[model samples]
Target chain A: MTGGRGSGLARLSLNQKTTNRWSVAEAVQGCVRAGLPAIGLWREPVHEIGVLAAVQLVTDAGLRVSSLCRGGFLTDPTATGRQAALDDNRRAIDEAAALGTDCLVMVVGGLPTGSRDLPGARHSVVDGIAALVPYARERRVRLALEPMHPIFCADRGVLSTLSQALDIAECFAADEVGVVVDTFHVWWDPEVMTQIARATGRIASFQVCDWITPLPPDALLSRGIMGDGHIDFRGLRRAVEAANYLGDVEVEIFNADVWDADPDEVVATVTQRYLDVVLDG
Target chain B: MTGGRGSGLARLSLNQKTTNRWSVAEAVQGCVRAGLPAIGLWREPVHEIGVLAAVQLVTDAGLRVSSLCRGGFLTDPTATGRQAALDDNRRAIDEAAALGTDCLVMVVGGLPTGSRDLPGARHSVVDGIAALVPYARERRVRLALEPMHPIFCADRGVLSTLSQALDIAECFAADEVGVVVDTFHVWWDPEVMTQIARATGRIASFQVCDWITPLPPDALLSRGIMGDGHIDFRGLRRAVEAANYLGDVEVEIFNADVWDADPDEVVATVTQRYLDVVLDG
Candidate 1:
């Protein structure tokens, strides 16, 4: 079953964090074993094995790099803070270029600590992205703005809706800055479908996961596997497909249960669910 | 301090849920002691004391009923379920009328259990509200659609944005159906100010609560007092004020700490916060 290649498997990308325990090498091998043609890489794990070695390892395994985990957190209000964030993101862009993936998912930082200035924080995000655009464009890396769920607005990502992300992404060239349509983050948006349609060419990545309720105390780990929660993955998949988003459909689950499970077993489950719940459903 | 009346206190309304332990009579007395001119009523507490007596309690206290807590949960898929919800909402409208508050806050129910059909659930909400509008009009009650934070979209309220709520509310007469502008629910929205301006005279209740991070295990209890978290309450107040929302500014916190605190102290804190953080900040 692991060796059998299917058309749906080609579109499926095992996002590294989904199998949280797996190292970059382990994740790549798992993708190859599961017949997934692609794997999304996270910076920390990629850096663990060294970016050059990580790139060589994935290339040797014949796996496509679907996307890099992130490159944004640009909501700092201080000049020093903004510069540090930009410098780090430049490094992230270099990593994305080295890894041979144009897509660099961006989770813009939330409000500065002890600050009630939401508008100021959001303005900084736009300005930070503007500053990074030329560098990203030169590197041929796309800054995929991720509009996180509103639950993360205060602490994780200030970009709270796909429409809001698109508004910012539109300011730059489509190839320079794009948006991520992650079901876990955006499924509840009333305008999600409308925004997805509008995203068309600007959709850099389409991440799939379910939004489970009774959110654990740690909301960052609240995502469920596609079939385990309330998301209509097939509908979202179809919407993106219709939006001309012919890119990797990265399965990015952040649930503690998925992380705790054996990586091989988790990969098998993702494969089956991606086919059943996301593709064929 | 409780006996001292200030101009800021006149525009303030203590949403009963903020002091979760207070019964209808207790809340009215608390409002009076705080020198607050208005109080937002909850259906369960009103029913607990009998709506008519609760009305008399507030009336004799010389307090105004700013708005009724809720009259929604209308996203059921089954005919029986929908009918039961509609019936319940009609009773809620009656209760709102009896309480001498035209604004019946509507927390349009979330997706039905075991259902991933969010669009369908949202449709049911609109249909349900449409069915309730005529009855509400007859009772001289305004159905105030409360666009809860998107975090509650799956299990509590499908109406996740003020703009989305206004879309449905605008379909009905402005006097018959209106929308709520709750800071905790919408402070993250990039279009919040624009939507608030669009709402104009249709703003039924302008609720304030800060969006604190590290949300508790129960997301429902995530609200903080106006100054305790990241919301810019004064900006929101000014926006609503500019929009000509000459109604009560309700403080509707749901934090466990707030609930467990002495209700009088909480009331005092809310009053002081309303003046310093909300009115004068």
Candidate 2:
């Protein structure tokens, strides 16, 4: 299983954060054990392993780097604050390039502290991304602007719709900046299917996770395994495919139950669930 | 105080659900005690006193009914399910008319059980409204479709955006079918301000409630006091007012903490919060 030869999942990637307790090495090993050809790395875990070593671990395990988790949170109101966020994103770009991942997912930050200027925050996001595009372009790391669910609009990502993200992405070259089609973030959108098709070559990454309800006190961990939630996985997968997005379909669950389980068993369970919900269902 | 002649809040209405524990009479008395001229009625509370008696209770107290809580759950899957939902809404229309409230709020149901047909559910909502709009129009009760937060799309309301609600509401007369601009549900939309303005005469109600983070297990109770959460109440109120929405600005909060507090104190605190957040702040 360590060879990751085949479960017929050439496009499946085990996003490390889905197994919150796993080390970089553990996730790479588990992905290989489950025949997942790729892995999506979060900044914290990559920093934990040192970028060079994390890259080596995945490469040695014969796993591809699907995408680096994030690169944007530019909703600050001050010039100094904006500069700091852009500088941080430059480092994230460098890390993505060094790790051999072309896509650096951007979860644009929400309203600046003590301010309720959503339009201003969104402007900050566009300007911030515009400022970083040249730097990211130089590094060949495409900034994948991910529009998180509207619930995360306050504290996490202000890009709450694929159309909103795409509108910003339209300001730059598609290869330099693009949008991520994350099922958990976008399944509720009325025009998601149309937007996905419209995204076309601008599709930077395709992330999959189911949206489970009765959201816990922390809504962040409400994501569940595919079949365990309400998303029409097959429908979304078809939309992504129709968009000509050939990137790895990264499984990125944030549920406490999935994270609390054994990484190996968790990987096996999710892979099967993905097949059942996305491919076979 | 029961005269409800003045506290300088002619445009304010205290929605009963904000103080979930208070009965219809208690809510009517509380509103009057707080010098509030209007109160939004829920179906349950009105049923408790019989709609006619409840109507008399508010009228005798010289307080007005701003809007009835709801009349839509039109997304159920079966023929029986759809018919039952429409029938129930018909009764709700009668109650709204009996209560002398022109606006009957609609919290359209989410995807039906064991179903992933969001488009189908949305169609059902439109059909259900079309079937009832004529009846509501005849009775002089306008259907005020309330788009719940996107997070509730799976299990509560499939109509998750003001734009989506407007798209459906446009099929009828603005006065006969309109949309409710609830800050808690729509503050996250990038186009909310623009949509609010575009809604114009179609705006039926302007409900204010703050969007609190780290939602409780039941996201229903995550609403906070105006200043307690991240919403731009002044901004929203400005937009709603600019839309020419001259109806009552209802204060509706659903939180365990708010509900657990003394209802009288809750009303006073919320009314004061409204004065600060919407009028003064």
Candidate 3:
């Protein structure tokens, strides 16, 4: 039931979080079984199976690694805390390099514990990314700045707009620092289309997911599968394509319902929806 | 203990939603009892007593009508839907004028019923506002465009940033169209300070609330009382003031806990927190 299944499937990639219950090997196997060309890997599971072994498994399965889950929580307020975060981000860069994916998604962190200095925290994120750029550049791992939805600004990521992310990323070379165009996080931005145009060569990864309402108690798991929410998928996909992003179009959903469902069925639904709503109108 | 009680109380206006249990008479009485100089009225409660009587209630209490709750849900796809919304907004303009307030907070509606046309919906909002401007201008009511957090863009406000709101408001005279700087919605925005500075004469109403996490099941009730969450109140307050907004500072919280509390207790807490966090810093 892969509805519009032609060149679209070649562009399709399954993000690991969409099938949260699956192990790294299982996700890779699921991608292969569903005829997916690539798989977006998460840090925790890759660490569990060991990055080297995970890399070997994906390579043997002929699956390209679209991206490494995340590598930035650089908003810690203390000098020691920031130093430690930099050390961790360096390790993440090494992992992203090992995974054979140039894109290392950066979820720049929010305010420190009880502090409300949003501007100061944002400055810390920029400073932290600046510290990581040289290392990422040396490793050939492009740091993909993921500007999360404003809902996560206080606790998850203070970087709230694509324009804001570009302001930071543009400070470095496009290949060294790029932006992640995750539809779920950015579909609501009035400037999103224009920003996508502005991203041009700086789009490290273009991920798709839907924005559903009556958000779950845990707002972090609020993402819906494509076509299930109010986002105009084809519109965004065309904009990303126009931005010259010829990379894998990753399907990254974070809904509890999808997590609870069987992974195989979820992959099938994703593939069908990707074709029906994303690649085609 | 009215904490830091002098000049600050003069500037404090309690939004009616903060005391959801109160009637127009009760809210007005509560403001005077707390020595607060104003009350931000909501249309429902005002309509509950008839707009004229609600006006009399506040006027006799020597309370200023800081601003009207709302007057724009203009994203309906059909012409009739939009025309009806425009007509309703006209009544709202008349109400605001009768109530003797110049500011009418406009929460431009979300995506149409099941449509994913975000750009289309946003264009409708702009058209809707454009349609209302003449009437609002005649009635001396400023359409305070509220750029809600992106979380609400799909259902509450398509306008998601102070910059976007200003972009739309700048199309008309500053008095006819303006923006609402609600701390709960704009606190997380990286460009808030700069946008607030840009809002200069267009800062229609400055509303205060805290952004509490572990959001309640209903995201609409996610707002916290001042100092209960992560907003830098004094900073936003100073920014609004610097923008030459010489108006009442309204405290509008929709948290269930705040709504469930005794209205008097809530008013006292708001006054105290306003003095401690927003004014004194």
Candidate 4:
């Protein structure tokens, strides 16, 4: 199962925390310095330095781009917002293609403003993805819809379950559309193993994070470090591997404390903890 | 269907906010004075005033007991904790029986402490209920497993989806276990309507509260009052009725603001909102 220790461990990737405190260049350098193999780059930092410069920076540091941070917020009550989101996703895809990332992760937006129509919002997400799949495929970038936790159903991502995400993925004719299974989002799912099996080769990425000790209303801000929270990362890894998903095991913690710490220390501590908790588990 | 206005709207039931501002008797009197039909009593206040006194207060006010605030937190890792929880549940059953409530709602706890075993915690919940079922049934007090939002998968409630709750309920004998579909917890579910149909006569109660804007970490403290947030109460009502759940729709908001307000005003506002937004919708 180790596939030889070094090679197997090399599959670890870091999803730069979404906060602007860390730049893409700095994040790439941090991963390289930590002997980490890959990094999941967020768009804002890349956009700040220009996509070309960001791509060059990663390439120069010999860091693999596992996935792009995001590409979708497709639910818009109006045509103008919806079209604008699609256009932005197109740019995201182009950026991912330039960076040579494995996939472009989509955090599909929640219900449109002033609407409680969850199903309608989901339909809009599917429609938006279907519209963008052709463009994504043309750029050779896989569009991975990240199913956020149900708490975000009101104002964040409408795709709140892996089954729902897989259903949306099936709507497209090609495998270009896939699902990103993040531990923070899905560790609590009773059907996690079954859904992971259903995902199998269709899983574009597998992200890991821990559930915090004290749950806050804005849960997105309080994610635990790999070993800090109660998620069975080892068990999840086994399930994902059993499902034939050989994607990078991306560490994506969103803890406020971790963010406030030194970025280098954050990367080092997370990488070591991921190895001990997940790989060693 | 209001069943025609002359029949009078189904009376709103106030679930006394958990903050320490009001005693059980005070809440009951406030509901009665506000012309509300029912009150859902929590355990702590019952403990404070004693169950017999709380029951007498409601009886004197001619206030119906819609449901007991809660009964289950059965996901403890230790046998001692599990046994104690079952004992507490039995006490809760006695309290509910004394109050003549429609049911004893169960907030089945999440993963046990120091463990990330979700399935094991779920098993504990099921076994706990199985152990308590005969006692509850003999007392003529129904058990209502209330599925909380997925965000509470760690410390609060593990049964986060309606379908999962129904699955657990199906494991029990007829009427041994039913479900409470709180819109605040499940309005975001993609399978809510389908699960409502599946739960049709098996529903012990229906709860209504809006999903708050900018959901905070302590979600229990941020619950929006009926029609205050984004839930389509009319749609939810139609679905619940379609499922043959003819129970009173209990307004169970745990908002800090509502709790800080005058209990009379809270009851009046919730009653008016229930009539205008839910019944009229």
Candidate 5:
């Protein structure tokens, strides 16, 4: 609010999961107190506050809801599992609509238990997303298909590359479905630059999380603060910008160290690092 | 070699690393006693026995040398580091030639210390391979480019996809440069089917290992015996076979549990599992 030029904070958004301990109101206040213009919301915190009130909270705070955390586990092998996933995603779409966010990120569930049918699991994801398309389109919410790292293909997601996510999203129009460009999941891809360029109008969300090595036993928590890891944030940010993706660059660190830090300090450190590595560096 | 019609063991090759306890002589004896005709050799063990003697041990035992486990660490950022890796790789090539194996598998190296330049590291690998091509061709050995899984891209191999390997390998004759189709490294790729189809005569080796979940702290030892994890061994094997890859199926598990087991029992379990899941399944 100082210069109104919005240079540094203009496209910056704090994804809620970055601060594991912060409640919805706390994260909102943390963003406001840190002078950020937007915040990404996770479903758990939004549900705790009630969807309508969650909407009112950010509205009163002069904050934008950059994206809703997630809306897919669509790759189950059984009919019951598939039906349940579709039903849950419909509710997620409603929540995103109520929260005034156009993007609902989908992590697309991995293989069904005890199953090695990777292709079948991938098909189920496509089918499940297709089932939710009408609902998401009607609500004006974009179903953002996020390709998790290949390591998660067996347990967390079947979509493991931007090309694969684009393959699924192509089944629907851009508004009904799109792809998320998360730096953590995709920075290792050889074709990432070309894929990011091809993403163009289809990039639903752009989340930043650097990859740190000597990965902990739990690979999920290997993501670190921007400047603390190996990701080329400047190159990737420039690629996304060239793709014409004008969206929030949500800082989404998942390291245990950052989670254990104070929310205020976490935001301050991350914001400065983001400006240094992603925006100005 | 009782029934010389190429018994049940004709196509099996036990990679030396699979049984960490087995010396070159021990592994050759174990393979012969278990009815296998071929054995894959690693450089460290070959060096331990003196490369010339390692070759004689397998030869006197009537076992064929399937491949030399590796000859690459070519991604170092510094000139001294690069030179050291090249020197080591050159020695490995000589050992492979002395052992009469036509294929030398290359794990290639990961990013250099404190360097996040993945592209630069990959370029180094390609350049390193090209440099070794003349020497490899003279020895009648093919430099087998093995694209490791993306998870290993940070610390193991920078070539993380078959197409990337083929792109480099295509720059030379098939006999001078080729690829290793390792099940554990590529079973997750969505483009794997097409890439394998495109590999054709370029597949110099076919290594089999399953990927077990909840990877241990040292992810390098995460591989398990066939049928013990999520890989479609038969499917991948068929793809390689269809691509005209007439080579030994080297069982190359690297788990701590496997390493702790008796070498003979380890060989038996892995062979039977390979037959069940990869050959007859």
Candidate 6:
């Protein structure tokens, strides 16, 4: 059962699942065939297909670019590594600008190599974002900082909660730095709804996915498909929409099972499920 | 190549190696023989030897009871399940009171069964703890809320950040609630030091362990022994001690590999490691 009938379907956007199976062009075409309105493109896919070509393909497919998959890996204890990450983020900003995407999602880096200095890493993230803000603002590209789950605190992203991300966003001037509300990451957060309300106008992008049972060894890449796992997407959508986030609701799944399935089938199943449960709610 | 040459050897704790092979009595005797000052006791071992008996064994041996393994699983969506958890927690508080332990550790339950309502579960936890606080205070037993990693957000603990736990603790009067700072769980927190400072006098327990590479399926149970994982316990110890927490530095490990070893050997290794790293540093 959906969250009260007649709530209406939430918008559907496809995040190119982080697998090498489907090319960017193919994924965009698949979304079109499945009747999905938007797509969240990853950097590697765009890089592989060439930024100009990827942009052209999205434009041709008549699909909205919900977000650019990532932009930040800011935690580099060393100057060399830090500079490199900032430089890469600059490139991502350029790519997002080229694609005419809604925003560039940021997965702020976790602890620096060989160290447990969490605060140090976080400081670097704030600094990295601050340094990139001017350029991002100039290009009119929103930097959406996506707070990962605490499981990724060691090797992935240091910003592990919606409140933490919002704090970082608040440090930046308005509109330049925004927050990305991804259900897979923040669904378990106790303050998620409260933070979503606080994030109202600051929400650059919104993503949806499910949390599965029996966590994987590498949880960063083991998210569940929309209806296959246990998350109240309709409830989450209602919260976000209540906060006045009119941005596209992107489906970002990182599951081996779905990747192993037929790509077209995956798209079709997700679209139908989204329409039935989330949108129709 | 440790934290510093003068820092001395790494201090290891037996928690990283618990696979249910040792009894509480055996582990305590082993720690004393190995010259380790403190030992963390789990519930099953206490139950096996009987609470009073275990407490007597440790006390008579001059071994400090660092912190009770756990006491909270407060979130249960159903009234019966919630009451059952609180009832069990009451028993745990009584046991801690009898053990003369520093604090009763609480691993607050995650999302309620078959439900993805994280906030609801968290509220239940607060209510559950508020219910237990009076009983614990009456017994003069301090409650230390240990925030588990976000990976456990679905099935284990809803409170995933030290800040979140600290906030919950602050809800109660200062003396009634405190926190168990486990390096394995909080090492990746972006606000680790700041939150630690905020938790200064409120810090009830400080547990040390390691985070090994290539996490396994049961990541929680696969914790690394001190010095074997990535955590810098010496630095962490300094932070906690700096916070004015004048308590035993409990060596709490949950490693599958260490548990399979002989209990005596496990104790000996952990004791030596703890002396070499923690006390030496």
For all predicted structures, in order, the TM-scores are 0.97, 0.97, 0.97, 0.96, 0.97, 0.89
Ranking by lDDT: 3, 1, 2, 5, 4, 6
Question: How well is each residue in A1-281 modelled by candidate 3, as lDDT tens digits?
Answer: 35446456998899999999999999999998899999999999999989999999999999999999898999998889999999999999999999899999999998899998888999999899998999999999999999999899989999998999999999999999999999988998888999999999999999999998767767988889888889999999899999999899999988888999999999999998997899865
Per-residue lDDT of candidate 2, residues B172-234 (tens digit): 999899999999999999889889988999999999998876566678888998898788888
- For model 5, residues B45-74, the per-residue Cα lDDT tens digits are 878879888878988998889999888889
Can you write out model 6's per-residue Cα lDDT over B238-261, one digit (the tens) per residue? 888889986776667676777777
lDDT to native, each model: 0.90, 0.89, 0.91, 0.83, 0.88, 0.79
Say which docking band candidate 6 falls in: medium
A-chain TM-score of every model: 0.97, 0.96, 0.97, 0.95, 0.97, 0.94
Worst 10 residues of 2 chain B by lDDT: B1-10
lDDT at position A58, candidate 1:
95
Off by over 4 Å in 4: A1-8, A18-20, B1-9, B18-20
Candidate 6 wrongly placed segments (more than 4 Å) = A1-10, A18-20, B1-19, B262-265, B272-280
2 or 6, greater by lDDT = 2
Worst 10 residues of 6 chain B by lDDT: B5-14
Predicted complexes: DockQ each? 0.85, 0.74, 0.82, 0.69, 0.70, 0.54
**What's the distance in Å from true for residue B58, model 6?**
2.2
RMSD of 5: 1.9
The 10-residue segment with the lowest total lDDT in model 6 chain A: A1-10
Give the per-residue Cα lDDT of candidate 4 at A87. Answer: 94
lDDT of 4 by residue, B1-281 (tens): 24453244445677776323778877777776666677788888888988888888998998888899788999997888988999899999999999898599999987776887888898988888889989988988889999998877888998988888888889885477899989988888888889998998788888888887787446667788777787988888899889887777788877778778876777668777887888854
Query: Per-residue alpha-carbon lDDT of model 3 for B34-126, expressed as tens digits?
Result: 999999999988998999899889889999999998999999988899889999999999999999999999999888889998888889989
TM-score of 6: 0.89
lDDT of 2 at A198: 81
Question: For model 2, what TM-score does chain A reach?
Answer: 0.96
Better of 1 and 2 by lDDT: 1
Q: CAPRI band of model 3?
A: high
